[model samples]
Target: MGAAVSDTSTRTTPEHEASRTPSPPGGRSRLAALGRAVARRRLLVLLLTLVVVAIAAALGGDVAQRLSSGGFTDPKSESSKAERFLADRFKSGVPNLVLVARAPGSVDAPSASAAGRELTERVAKAPGVLSAGSYWTMPGAAPLRSRDGRSALVLVRLGGSEDDFRATAKRLVPKVGGRQGVLDVSVTGSAQVSVEIEKRSEEDLAKAEAITAPATLLILLVVFGSAVAAALPLAVGLLSVLGTFLVLRLLSAVTSVSVFSTNITTALGLGLAIDYSLFVVTRYREELASGRDVTEAIAQTVRTAGRTVLFSSVTVALSLAGLLVFPLYFLRSFAYAGMAVVALAAVGAVVVLPALLALLGRRIDAWNINRALRRLVPHRRERGPATEESGFWHWLATAVMRRPVLFALAVVAVLVTLGLPFIRASFGITDDRELPASAPAHVAAQALRDDFDSGESSALSVVLPETDADAGRVGSFAARMSALPGVFRVDAATGSYVNGRQVAQPGPAAVRFRAPGATWMSVVPSVEPYSDAGTRLVQRLRGAPGAPGTVLVGGQAALLVDTRDALAAGLPWTGLIIAGTTLVLLFLFTGSLLIPLKAVVFNLLSLSATFGAMVYVFQDGHLQWLVGDFTVTGLLDISMPVLMFCVAFGLSMDYEVFLLSRIREVYMETGDNTRAVALGLERTGRLVSAAALLFATVMAAFATSGLTLLKLLGVGLALAVIMDATVVRGLLVPAVMRLAGRANWWAPKPLRRLHERLGLKEA
Candidate 1:
């Protein structure tokens, strides 16, 4: 009876198993478990974070709208206040528009007069136009009378928002009748310039998207060696950028966020998303090769690589937060925006990405379709034991160990040489020449300079007492200012009024000075605007002879001078904050003081090389065409260096974390420095190279952008990454660590305890 029952049971078991079908336990099961875990947690965190971001976005949007509607007014610095007051009081109450007219051959009296009238009438009747006049109507306005009479000018005053004013100008241009010789009609003014900037900004954003999106996609594909895997990172990166824009749009309401910030965020988000995802995917692949079940591999990848990403993001955010030390509103806005993007990228990489990978299962590598092709690729495997003379890494280890100190010194020397140019660096605001020569604003500015004293558009405000008692004092002050070397002319109408009417003529009061050839030497001793020379000039002018009861100097130059001073004052603090914070994060991760110190020193070298290259390229006038078309104005923008420092430092750290994390991993397993460095480099070298290439492509794409500032940023950042990854990290880092040997991991007893408690675990 027992034998009969057993036979029946075996037959029944075979039938049941055949019907049910066994599930594959390789990649699919692990991915599914990972998806479940992430779905459960990510939904809650994402919803919460989205809610917070939404609220912040709404508030920011309101602020931006109010600020924009209020009109664009730069905050008053000490030097700017006086100029602001003068501009408020003396300049025409309406924004000014400039018009130029040309004839086929030569502009004769008849053509000039006809063109002037035609333009004036057209401009005056245009919407938002307050008034329009030609040289014929305003005698002694010699600047408007072209020397050759081939060109004629008309000035129009506009009312309302800049957009309204620009529309009026645009409409007026096409309406002016012209002879067969006239090629085109051009209108230029502050309002028109603003419109052009906005238009150009939109164009730049589109260009950035076009370049960054595909470049990022290509980079991910190359890194993952699989289209599906690559697409996952790209998708997350796009989401990060979209979320960032939405956040920025909202923030723009309450604060002034430059349109440039959007491009920056996009580039950063894509780069970081790719970077974080690469690390995780790489680990995930390693786990699969090691024969881990799908669920186990996914869990291990998240536990290890995901944690590293979290730490890396935190470090970058902290570095960006240091921008808060700056008083500049633009820098502050950038810092907040950048931090938000970094946080989002990190979260997306760890959360949304894992879930998606789980759904894809074995398909993560499905894109690597040729099973035979996949088999041909070498898999990561542990050698019998790490030693000084056994494998591909062993040879590299031996070579580096031979001349560590010399390599270190040579690298330092090279970096120092590159950095030398920055000591003589100078900065200025974006100049008119930054625009394309064909741009109406650029043409108008050139025309104004060539026809007038070159100072008509840029004026200085001199403050004197408003009362009659200070008339003599005011006149003396005006005279002294007029006598200054750069001063072209002085307009001090003590009793003058608009409409040619006399108001209560006060005693000689504050005047406006137009300086055409203003030099940094005359303003302050420094070669840069807002430098020591500018500050000194402000101080001297404040105490000029017959000074008003309260004299103040203000204008564009003054504002720039203030900006320079603010940057100069804040630079030390910013540097210290960035360096200190970087060290703390590095120390926390590596549990070794030496590693953090080495990273900081190496990062500084990379930064110096980048700055020196910029000075040579942008400031010193070398390779101008290769970088992009830019007017070599002999100075850099004051804010650019500060922004570069914070940004470059953070990005350099990104590479450092990537390369060093691998080295640290190898070291923990082997306790062999030489073996670890060589193996680590072998493992991460391709990824780092790929990342650098992607970054370079993204930045170089911006070379075609019309915006000079964006071009500068792109070139500078791209150069830094390439140099750091290839030269500093590839050669110097390993060489120095090889020489340091056991000392590399040395930590004091108290610190060791701390590291044990807080140190990041290896992926």
Candidate 2:
């Protein structure tokens, strides 16, 4: 049998191994064949990837055109119904812009009239503006009256879809700002919102490079202790990001890709590249120190560290793929873009990196110096053997393990307490004032609100037919709607003659309304805009009577109302999908049910804490200064929480795989959970921390972008990663595993058999 094994191994590599060994082995032959295969075909794979990306890019313009032509069409959705009704009655969509004019202090009669007239003239001539008029000057418009009479608003209707409006606004903003006596000018419309999202995404990409590149370099310098070694990971990471962008640009042609997708893809790719490269390079150094030749060290690194990286990358890609369960187009694009970036980074690490290492050999470490500076900064290997565990980490693990039940209970209690704020969570798309106080949009929005009827720039309309024009019928409908509680006022255009004719006009509309920023509605109990309560109100209004016609309710409040409902309805299913997928992947990787269960539990805990912190800072108005100037509108965006959940869960699982892969390797070899946990943490902790910090810093740079939504996402994600790396991964992970002991690796006998048959072996 031994002679046969030797003969089998030598068959593929007789010339190469004949001088080094007496006999070849099967494992050696198989590995040699695999290496040769990869070496032979690498150029083809790379060229194929580039070709695919180029094809996709070529198709993107057509895809964008199709998406732009498909305007808002969800009539069944509450907001869509309102939009349709408004379109039919007014022969137009919602006003595209709200232009504000403020008096020196407060608006007097003369100032109000002058401001309104001037705004009308200036806005009407504004480029890209189809029509601009003052609501205060229009007949039968009572909602435009401001209590203090200090502000006036000009409503500008633009021609086109949201994207068109955005393109128009980008050209119009500078011109609007140039107008005389315009204390502040802001274009707040759907188009402006899209523009802002795109602008912020670009800014985030720039900031990510600024932060991630430097942070990654610093980390490499610390780990490899050589300038060349430190620079290699950054180079690989940059290449991965560039390749990812080219691919995404191509995918955008055939699919609806979110503006935010590029930023997210770049961040994920850079992080993984740094992490995977760190693992391989570190292992290669170890092999070199053990007196292995350059080619041998590269081969050993590929066989061991490269396999770990492949498994880790596969697990992460699967986790991100869970985002497909979300119905939102943006999220689906995020999943595609994120998964592609991660896969590419993995390939770069395992294939491109190995080829480079093979070609560079000992030259990779040639930058090492033995001068005074070098003495002051010892190399990673020179610092000490990794077998020695720090007293701090050891004590922490022991204390938690000593009182396993208490530690577990304490963690759960803390997480639950933090999560309480989310129970009453509300979401909405806020006015421009939600931006920092210094932002032009915020200043303009506040000025508009202060000078006009708070609702002048905002109103809730219920469209009813002009045929119901009798005093009794109009009075009854108006009284019923107004008295429905929370209804501020109801204006029915009764007894009015159009073109001097008294004939009942079926298309003539009746508008019912409420106070600006009111939290209540007749159809549902008083609830904040975009909250579950408000969404329910929208549903009730849609079902309400309008005699011969349907009543559609819409406004900023209504859009938020619908968005919240959609998110809430979808959240439970999304959570289940993510959790289920993560569990399956963990079981497949570790061949243990307990580890996956533990991972899920801890991930939830980390997520809960993250949400609580978001509420405390963004909602409850804590740490306002540290986070930058943001107005607390007492509500969060409904989509923010769902987006955060998907992102945070995936990232937490990413670190879990990194830490646990090392632990599992040790466990398989020694069957000692405690020793494995300790040693694994010690070995992987620095790299994990570095990776987390790089990501956090990249995200944190967005806080300065002057976009509230992007800033919120950045701050929220940065906090989650910091907490996960330090609190969850560093402390809680080891503690729980030590307590679970042998049971953590337990699997049923049948499952073990399955694992043996199908399990992936370490390369």
Give the per-residue lDDT digits (tens) of candidate 2, residues 1-763.
Answer: 1121111221222211211222224543454444444445656645655565465455442332233311212225666665554444443344657666555555445655665566677767866676566644553444343456554556666655455566777787666653435333345555554555466556555765776566666766766677777776765676566676666666756755666666677667777787788788888888889998766677677766776677777767766666665555566666776788788788777777766666566877766643447669866556655433554554455455556667777777877888788776656664564455765656665665555433434445554433333434544444455444333444444422222232232222223221222111112123343445555555555565443344557765677666556666666777677778777777766777798999988888888888987888887778877877777877776567767777777777878887877777666655556766776777677777877887787778767656666678888888888888878887788767867766777777777556555554442
Taken over the whole model, the C-alpha lDDT of each candidate is: 0.64, 0.62
- Residues 1-763 of candidate 1 have per-residue lDDT tens digits of 1121111222222212221222234433444455447745655645655675566455543332222211222364665455334344433322246666665555555765665666567666776666566565544432355676666666665664444555655565456523323323566656566556556756776777786776667666667877788787776676676677677776765666665666677678877887788888888788788998666667777766776777788877877888777777667766866888898888788777776666666778876634546588887686578533344443544455566787778888999999899999977665455566777677776776575433434544555424332345444444556555444444454322222232233322212221221100111111222345544555556666665556556544666766777777777888888889888888867777788999888888888989998899888889976976766677777777777778777877887887778777766655656666777777777777777777777777777777676778888888888888788877788888877765677677787666655655453
Model 2: lDDT of residue 343: 82
Global Cα lDDT for candidate 1: 0.64
Model 2 Cα shift for residue 731 (angstroms) = 2.3
Where in model 1 is the C-alpha error above 4 Å? 1-36, 39-74, 83-138, 141-144, 149-185, 212-215, 369-398, 465-470, 495-540
Off by over 4 Å in 2: 1-76, 84-90, 102-132, 143-150, 173-187, 193-197, 204-208, 290-292, 369-386, 389-407, 461-479, 491-540, 543-547
